[model samples]
Target: MDAIDPVVGFFGLGLVAGMLRSDLKLSSGLYDTLTIYLLIAIGLKGGFELASRDVTALMLPTIVIVAASAVTPMVAYQVLLRLGRLPHPDAASISAHYGSVSVVTFAVGASYLGRQGLDYDGYMSVFLVFLEFPALTGR
Candidate 1:
């Protein structure tokens, strides 16, 4: 049972469905409901685990996480504006997208690590929540 087997299966199903022109589109309401459910589940799981840990111990890592979140957007904006020669607004918009964390990507990474019998800090979900705000507000 490979960790990525399910991921691959879902991707293949979507591809096959699209190629066959199947009428399998999700309704907007269903899509929104699923998204909300996923987010709530992730947040609750993380929060339940995080609640048992010492806040002081997580402080330094949280600071570093916040700093990285702040710095990444600025670096992205500069690269897009200077190297890509994009307009200011376009560069900023792209940078904001890069700065925010994708919960779906995080979930996939966590699944991969779990399959490999590896562990990450439980506080990472808190970091994801923090990372989302600065990118949007900073711009």
Candidate 2:
């Protein structure tokens, strides 16, 4: 409960701001800067974790995750096109979005787990980075 209070509070703050038509907004440059900073920080932490581990220990899991990332978009496209009855272009666009990783979600989940005193490999951040390219390129 304590771990999630800040999240809920911020969400409520945002909701109130929106309802009041608050003029506060993030500039595009600030948004891009924050995004790059987060990516670099995550990558640096992952690199440090990987540096202390045996490479071969991670190879199999890395390969498996990359392969799955590559395949996700195609499966999503098929599901959207066939089951959702969406047109080809719309399905492709939506599937691409579905396939890519959400950095915010990853960060939030990691933070939550840490707050709960659960253990996880920080190296998983490396996998999250790897997931982006294959999902975006479908290869």
Question: lDDT (CA) for every model shown?
Answer: 0.81, 0.83
Cα deviation at 28, candidate 1, in Å, is 1.0
Best by lDDT: 2
Tens-place lDDT digits, model 2, residues 54-106: 98999999998888787888899999999999999999999888778888778
Candidate 1 Cα outliers beyond 4 Å, as residue runs: 1-25, 136-139
**How many residue pairs of model 2 clash at the backbone?**
0
User: Candidate 1, which ten residues in sequence have the lowest lDDT sum?
Assistant: 1-10
True lDDT of residue 24, candidate 1 = 86
TM-score of 1: 0.78
- Residue 107 C-alpha lDDT in model 2: 75
- lDDT value, residue 23 of candidate 2: 83
Highest TM-score scorer? 2
TM-score of candidate 2 relative to the true fold: 0.80
What is the clash count for each candidate, in the order shown?
0, 0
